[model samples]
Target: MKKIALIFSLAVLLVLGLSTAALAATNGPHGGFTTNTASCAQCHKTHTAQSSHLILFALVSGSQNDIYRTCTYCHSSTGSSHYDEVDGEIKDGSNLWATSAGGFQSMPTVEGATSYTTMATVSSKHNADQANNTLVAIPGGSSALKFELRCDSCHDPHGTQNARQLVPTVTVWNTLGTAYNTVSTIPNGAISMTVNNPTTNETITYNDDHINDFCGACHTDYLQTAVNSGSTQSGTYTSGLYRHRVGMAAAGASGYNAAYFALPTSSPAGDVLCVTCHYAHGTTAAVSSTTYANGSTLLRMDERGVCQDCHRKTFSTSQPAVVAASSYQVSATDKNHVVLAFNSYMEKVSAQTAGNYTVTGTGVTGVSSAQLQPNGVLGKTVLLTLNGSLTTGSSYTITVNTTTVKDLNGLAVSSTGNTFTFSSK
Candidate 1:
């Protein structure tokens, strides 16, 4: 019996040992001692340390930007890694040369004059260069959190549980409080990028849904709560706040194309995060379109192509139709107030004219006024006020005149689909 017990104890020990090994962290290259201790010498030195933090500067011969050179040794266009962030290309021994977060800046020539201008159109970048990046107050953070930007400021060389080895902690300003007094950790899995080389025929996927949480770590004021489709305005200001809502569902068959805006897991559709429109690294994309001519802000597409891709307002030649699902929210304070939501962006002047609408229902009177929501001039919803109050729990019908209410593309609202019914609050 004693011999049998010893054999069982040995089996249990083996299982525990295997479990511990499986849970070990495998931080890539810079530090994952459990996987390989040899990686330490690649960046650190014991006796021949060249720089502070024992960083081995022997890899590159540049002293001006030694710290930046170390990271770029494996991450730049001339480096050995699959991701060429310096050139914003994925060079997996293939000809695809797909652009991602556009490169940091122009690549340095072989002569080391730093005048390579392959992506010169990408006028702006994160500026991770150690020599050039200056000490500045964080965009959405407090004065107390002033920091000189660097590659290590955002990335953790030692590794982390989050994707891309993002730094775990940052000091952010609390807008609700009087002082810069919030220390926060980026939520796990808020931003993740998966890319495979074409030589291996791998797919590149980026599902950075809560990326605002990561960017908001420093740009605190830019983060916003999600709003609904009908209430989402394009450009309007009220009480010092812009009405361009982020973190909202970019859903609906009529408003957005499912193919161009497909997300990994958006239930019925995808939500719009910060990275949805902007590239994380940087972009060399040109922006010379007539509608939205602007400087490079690391956008995925040129000019306002990112906006038009999902909004699809300019692309629509189809007649506008009322979306019954979102149009039914009536004002509780004023029973006469009713909101109408359309699938396409409507022209402000025509949609807000009272002469273009007629209201008929139980205990209803003449239409008093029609007004588009102050949210946007090119928004999808319009508010209507009746001359009299609607009966509680009573149904009402409204009609939009054909050829009067038009979309931004000058297509009239469909007369056949003009009539809609809503219950009074």
Candidate 2:
């Protein structure tokens, strides 16, 4: 009887031990280390250690702006094992580069320069003392007061149940779903935390879809789905169709090429969340087949690789129907029929310089007129009207070359297979 009683007691203790471990693992992502008060303190100290931040006073390869060099110290500069670069090779991990697609600045923010308010790149001379990035206002601030663009702006070092440790209020998108944006419920509840000694598993459970809202907290203007018109071709902003599609639904829907594209596991219900497309810190240097810089975009692959993952088609336009005939002989129907089915992505049309289009044909006579769709946005296709008609059972060839037409990164349209034939009837 005594032996049986002792065995039962030991079994109960074992079960309790296992239960405690399971609970701890559920709360703490870093090897069961509770992400409570000290979550951020682990990285920073009250004394503000200079070693924590990398200061550049004429160092090695190239100069970095004050923003990138500072925060990347932990994850980038020191060759730390946690470095975010692809091959662990550093090429400056700042998010601001040439393409400020959804940036708040009227002009681009540059590095290697002291001030970002005016210049587009970073100035090496501008230290923390010279200019405060927070002095200038971001898109969405609760107080309407200006703040610096720092890591604290988006994250809470102390750690929270929120994904990526983002502040709570930030979970709500500032844009309020103005036009075509995702509308999802935000969670507001206290969660548990756990801590275990000597562990490296720091994963957070992101249950809700608030990444877009988090990005929108500062880039409010990015939520706008409106086209921009300007005088200079480069000056115009017209990617309204699907530029930085934040709140837009991504649940395998029509707006996106759902036929081929699949949503990431992170994106719930198929919303193209911010984190879905961009990395929190910058990415390692990488180039795409189209000769565009995909590293900066932080796309899953690189450059336009994000879009090309599902949309794999060549650039070609075809005439559905040749103009039959007309009294003036200049067939408006034929001209409209010669539409270019842009299998490839297009940059804004205004960027399309004049005298860049070259249309020629053998069977078709008098190629009267041609024009791009949407006037200047990154339209999916170009409408070309022809002045000639196709005869019964007659085959003809027409070629198109918008040599100046390019993707967002300025890679010109493929100059091959611009030809099309009318095969029957």
Candidate 3:
């Protein structure tokens, strides 16, 4: 009788194992573990007739649309019972998320009709959907394949180490700031985002090394230690000005100086990346006040304000600082203007030299910084007082010779012909 009871128990164990397998197969792919369980079939089916991509659950993808439907299944307000499915309006909302993991719950969506693609006037945006034109040539890549920017250019469907499942690596966008090398957009990775449960406030953290490697993959120029000595700089570098540096090495947790960057490089848990400055999905164009999105690049903060975060006036080394504060606003906040804005905030200028700041206009005192709107970090216009000349409504050109001004390493900021023009009142 005891032997029979043992045999009955063994039979029950076998049945239980099969039931577990069945349950795994029944669960959807979004939450199921693929390696040891059922499979992606939980989300996609081979014969159920979904999109060209084979995404299932009646989610269809035609020639024109991208993967929005399948992805939003669990990411949208109507789609999932999970957190509020809405764009976080730049991380201000509760329970936000990005296509990248470690992101806030606020994510852009198609059904929600909220993506940079919908911006009528914005020029620089990642067109994640358009099927035909799915690739961009990443600047520093060795071969054509590595340079290809696909539909999911900045994302991964499977999952990754970085937030929102952003691509783990990218080719360096090594531009030399010359006519020969113009820069462009970047790529995403395979797939899958790591998200925290808002109900419990569970969180995940990332390291700066990974952040550096990921962002450095594309934005290679700033991180490059050396500049091109010859007319061209490709696989070669000599000595270049140190950029407001980013990357794992410069991450705050990595013993990098906080006077430069705050803790939590990019994420609240800590570690920084490109997203810390420029919004990955793009923001309203602060590129320029006049023709925004028209031509100016969209930036998270006005170009100069991005600098003010740490360097209230000066950084670690001594050099004529990149102007203490802004006297200018709503103008072009693009790279060329910002980089050359060495004196953008020189409120008062005295003609110490005869031909420099006073070549045509007189040097006066009391001009600092002023702009129309302060926009959080924005300051005022760079004021230059006229001293030697007296004229009303007459225009004059002032040229500042940057070669005379040097950096910490004693490098000239600009060679010649850096000018600003304003009419006399």
| Clashing residue pair totals per candidate (backbone < 3 A) | 3, 34, 49
Give the per-residue lDDT of model 3 (tens digit) for 139-220: 3333333322332344456544444545444322223211112222333332222344422233333433344445455545
lDDT of 2 by residue, 225-277 (tens): 22331221221122333343444455433334543342242423454555555
Model 3: ten consecutive residues of lowest lDDT: 330-339
**Candidate 2, which segments miss by more than 4 Å at Cα?**
1-73, 77-146, 169-207, 224-268, 283-425
lDDT per residue (tens digit) for residues 104-207 in model 1:
76421111011232224345566566453345565445455554555665676777555467665753223342233434576663466554343222333555
lDDT of each: 0.56, 0.36, 0.35
Q: Which ranges of candidate 3 are over 4 A from the true structure?
A: 1-39, 58-65, 81-124, 139-154, 160-205, 219-244, 248-272, 289-298, 314-425
Task: Give residue 346's error in model 1 in angstroms.
Answer: 25
- What value does the lDDT take at residue 63 in candidate 3? 44
Candidate 1 wrongly placed segments (more than 4 Å)? 1-28, 59-66, 94-96, 106-121, 130-133, 171-183, 189-193, 196-208, 228-239, 252-254, 259-269, 288-294, 316-425
Compute each candidate's TM-score over C-alphas. 0.54, 0.36, 0.43
